[model samples]
Target chain A: MILHHLYILGITVEAITGALKAGTKKMDVFGVIIIACATAIGGGNIRDVLLGNHPISWVGHPEYIVITTCAALITILLSPFMKYFHRVFLVLDALGLVTFTIIGVRMTLALGHGFIVASIMGVITGVSGGVIRDVLCRDIPLVFQKEVYAGVSIVSAWLFLILHAQGLPEISVILITLGTGFSLRLLAIYYNLEVPKFNYTQMD
Target chain B: MILHHLYILGITVEAITGALKAGTKKMDVFGVIIIACATAIGGGNIRDVLLGNHPISWVGHPEYIVITTCAALITILLSPFMKYFHRVFLVLDALGLVTFTIIGVRMTLALGHGFIVASIMGVITGVSGGVIRDVLCRDIPLVFQKEVYAGVSIVSAWLFLILHAQGLPEISVILITLGTGFSLRLLAIYYNLEVPKFNYTQMD
Candidate 1:
């Protein structure tokens, strides 16, 4: 529970940074805050909807919106320090990815879905938020482009499933899954790794 | 059934226009076609997912992709004539809006949801594709800001629901709903109508 709150806080921070990076002066504060909230919770919302969860996760808990609003204000104020912010953003993004993937898989499994369905849900929950944010901001989604993004989430989900199947403790399974995702993402970034693009000519 | 086929053909046209408008020289024909299909089918995808329908509408009928692919090729080849294509795009967009809204309401009712849910779903389906298209093009959604776009869908949805409740036949309900949406949208554009923005007070 404590970890979940902290994870959500980190999401708020990332969402704020994303909003500041995407905002124009023409947009009002409400618009900026809404965008920040969407960036923070959009992926999870889509996942929940797909899973047939009603009221939505964030809609049921308005704290997420309040946190994102505060974060957005701070981000706008700290815009001058952006040079030092990228690393922080990257770390938080990785954290968000792991947290969302774990939660997604767990939620779907609890809903009686099998491993394959849970894994797909995990990936969707992990990456759909960033996709929504990018789409709203009018940019190519990093997951769909040159990044080892969705791959990390998928691997993490598989690891969690395998661990669960092996009768590992739930806490250990979660920790290991998160660690695997974080390490894989960090290594990919360090090595500038990317997913192979589909070859059109090969299809022809 | 005839109307359904016409609706599919209209979707094909929109997919082609969307691909041409995406204008990403780096993206190959396959990528362009995938995007076009996504733009065309994304709204219905959201609707079905929300309603907990599996396999998705487009996934069940893979021929949608083929149609969209052909549309993309036509758009790409005729790119030079796109400047004068706005009128045709407008017509197709209106048709898409009406068709999608009718389908949305029909599906929602089939799911046994109430009138309000059905109407909301109608508006969501009607506007979601254009929203997807704009996002892929990296532009602020035109539906979010300009014109009485979604509003027309909403009104038409209400009209359909009211008439249906009064024991109107299915075909009459659909035709009236489409006519209402299309005419209202065209009139809104001709008259340069816009949704009123929320007025927020400064928090000193």
Candidate 2:
């Protein structure tokens, strides 16, 4: 439960970073907070609605809003140190990817979905927030490109499921999943790994 | 049934527009096609998923993809007519809004949800495609802004419900709802009608 709260906090941080980097405009406090909140919890909101969970996660827990608001404020105040923003964004994104993937898989599994569905949910939850953020910013989503971004989350989800099946402890499964996702993402970024392009030429 | 097919066709056209606008340097043909498809059917997709309809509207109908692909090809070929793009976008957007609002309300009614839920669903459906388009483009959703945008759909939905309750014929209800939304949206755009902004000074 404490870890869950930490995970949410990490998401708020990520949202702040994403909101700051998304546009060239100097967004006012309200706009910053709104973008941060949308980036942090937008995916979960969509996921909950799709799963028929009423009241939605953010509606039920307004603390998420408070946290996101605070994070956005802090980021806005510290906007001068924009040079470090990229590094911060990368780290926070990796954290968000791991945490959301775990949460998504757990939620789907709890709802009695199969492994394939749960894995898909993991990827969706992990990347959908960034996708939403990019859309709101009026830019193309990085995921729509050939990035190996979502692939890491998919692999982590499968690893978590496999670990669970092997009778590993819940904490072990989560740690492994998080570690795997973070490492894979970091490596992908370092190596500039990307997915292969679709064979558009073959279509004709 | 004809309306449904028209709605699908409008989505295809909108998707193609989005693809052409998305730019070839930033995204390949496949990426453009995917973004366009998402923009076209994204609103209805969210509405159906939220309403807990199985299989999803687009997934259940593969013809949507064929239409979207053909539209993308045409839009790409006709990319030179940049002056007419905005005008085309406005007309297509209006059509999409009216059609999706009706679909949302009708679907909600079919699912036995109350008028309130149905109206909310109508607003959701009407605004969702733009939201998806904004998100795909990485911009703040027009729905979240202080626009007269979604409010028109909400009002039209309630009007449709009230007319239905008054024992109006089905065809009349549909026409009235569509006309109300179409006219209201055009008028709003013409006059630049906007939603009232929340005064921050009034808050504690």
Across B1-204, the per-residue lDDT of candidate 2 in tens digits comes to: 656775875686667656754554355454566567667777777878877785566445656756776777666666666446665566666766777788789889999999999988988887777677666656567766744777877877888899989999888898888888878877777777888866567656
Summarize candidate 1's per-residue lDDT along A83-183 as a digit string, tens digits: 68778778778878888888888988898777766776787688777777776666676565445777788788889999999999898898888788898
Every candidate's lDDT: 0.75, 0.73
RMSD to true structure for each model, in Å: 8.1, 8.1
Give a tens-digit lDDT track for model 2, residues A26-59: 5667777778888888878766765666688879
DockQ value for model 1 = 0.10
**CAPRI-style quality class for the chain A–B interface of candidate 1:** incorrect
lDDT measured at residue A39 in model 1 versus the true structure, 0 to 100: 79
Q: lDDT of candidate 1 vs native?
A: 0.75
